[model samples]
Target: MVFKELRIMRGPNMWSRDHHNIIAVKYIPEDIPALSAEQFHAVQEYFLLNFNDQQRSEQNTLSQFKWTIRLAALLQDKNFSHDLASPSPDILYGILQYKTEQGGVAALETAAQIITALVSAKEPVSFLNASLYIKEINLRNDFGPSTKIIVEAAQARNIPVQKGPAGYIILGQGENQQRISAARTAATSAIATNIACDKEDTKAFLESSHLPVPKGVLTEDLSHLQEIAESLGFPLVTKPLSGNHGRNVTCKIKTVEELIAGFS
Candidate 1:
């Protein structure tokens, strides 16, 4: 099988409006020829017998095989589902439009790999590794610790929650709506954001508050960086002045060479 392309639908799209967060994967079954119903059923039965450990269905349609593998993968570790699948006439054919909140290419890609594994089960594929891969995908796309807590807490109270842009969680609807992203809220001021974002300014503010902060210096040139390294000693960290989610951060430098590379 050949995977052609992947498209992330962030908002209202041709496939779905309600379920906007989706991964549209274009794939092709390589070396596949037109087949009779019996041939197709035989192939499908072979796959089901391979996964005899899991529940199987008799009917084998494009969507059924996809959903079976999808559910099987979901049970392997995390929750996964799709809104629908469609066929295309263009070069990029056989669209696997799967719904995913966090994973981009992972969900569809994993499905394709799982199908390949099932087909290769005759020679005994690495089913254990495949299951682990699915679990890893689930964990990879799961919400952060704090974010998950907030989401679960809201759900306990029967609030309507949806994923928001920029790693936020939206609760309720219309006038009663509220948004939370980690510790920040809609009422968080721009000033507070600035103080938190700029590492230099944040250190200064914390120091002024008589709080201990990590010893580091912000630098824009090689000379300043060298000065910081020499003064602060080895085993240092480097990062952009203002960034989030470890965007440009590099850590644990024990040598000048590594420090220079990290800064660069």
Candidate 2:
């Protein structure tokens, strides 16, 4: 088995930021026996038998194994392309998206390892070892470095810290319960946050308040993009009307061709 790629995606992505941290792995299962209906069922059974342990309930483990089998089946089906060439070789791919509270990357990696073990029928695979590794990783990442600092500070101040669903932390309790998300507090202005989220809106608001802002026009039309770029002069910036963290944003667009490509 050859792993083609392994990546850990963090922050806001296609998946829910509050709930999911995805670990994506692409591998070629050349060493594994040919994927057949019988082989698929055997792999599924093997996964159920070997992967269950004290770390997770049997039901949850079965659920995860089912999902892995589905992915494997999807990849095994030759009708659909996995973005490879038409005459592509057989490939096995899997993605594990774990809840931030459940261990995130650690859980994802363990799941991938389980799938690999089942597919290849590899021996010396210990669920106990995997469980312990996941536990260690969970302990290390349960409270991220920044979150740990905040948790410690809250503890020092005698604020009751309670873990909430999807990586949220609640400081204090009952009516006095204050939610803490990274540096954001319960009192953080929702209107301000929304305004800050939209780059064009933020620019407009700042300009209205006599603050300096980049001169840019927002348009979805590619034809209009060139016109707007020409009006603004060369070396302009192109970005999605509403986005964050520089997603789909291209800067220093100096020519019409560059603007067109940047917009696309």
Candidate 3:
């Protein structure tokens, strides 16, 4: 089921299973400049908290977030605009939603367990990282379509939500089922009138085209082969006449063995 193009698609009939809502967003490095300091802070916290948990990729996640913050600061210093001449924003964002009752409970339990362990570790980095993870335990924004659904659901429940910027979706026929029939109709209307020729067919067509083409004989006889070869001149090029992309074309052939190889 889609709510305002945010697909909160149902899963299996079982009540235990979770549903997923998906949204697609495009990204380019240039959009960092438009983001306010608070927005960038939110982004930093988002990566530190949400992404690390989502994919269970904490080490790389921390590294990437640090790199991103550094890059954003660098861009601001350089006074460089993201897009050279275009009017579009430099960055894009998407939201996805997942409906998981058991998953949420499990996540909560895991958070508590990690908090206990973090205190035991007594490391600032470890404690900070664990705290971020705990903070993101309830975060549903990183997943694209989910964010839209959450906002809509909250609104439905009388919770006022300022909607995030709408995303631009570029779908192709390969993924969009609605375009299939139209694509098929267009393809049928643009059908090729001429059928492709096989080797024998092409040989006949080329011979008829008044080109210097060698005559082809049925495999049963050597007499016609020699006769045609003699007529065409001793040093002749032989090839499979119906091939494409230079598949079987042979040139500069003086020996009979090379001719046989070209034909066979």
Q: What global local distance difference test value does model 3 have?
A: 0.36
Model 3 residue 198 CA deviation (Å) reads 2.0
Distance from true position, residue 74, model 1, in Å?
A: 6.1
With a 3 Å backbone cut-off (N, CA, C), the pairs that clash in candidate 2 are none
lDDT, model 3, position 213: 57
Candidate 3: list runs displaced more than 4 Å.
Answer: 1-195, 203-224
Tens digit of lDDT per residue, candidate 3, span 98-185? 3232223333233324322332342223334443443354343232443444444543543323212342222122443121121122
lDDT ranking of the models: 1, 2, 3
lDDT of each: 0.59, 0.57, 0.36
Candidate 3 to truth, TM: 0.24
Better model by TM-score: candidate 1 vs candidate 2: 1
Winning model by TM-score: 1
Residue 228 lDDT, candidate 1, scale 0-100: 83
For 117-147, candidate 2 gives per-residue lDDT tens digits of 6555665246567656666656655666566
The per-prediction CA RMSD against the true structure, in angstroms, equals: 9.2, 16.5, 19.8
Which residue pairs clash within candidate 1?
A: none
lDDT per residue (tens digit) for residues 41-73 in model 1:
544564465465343343323433354335443
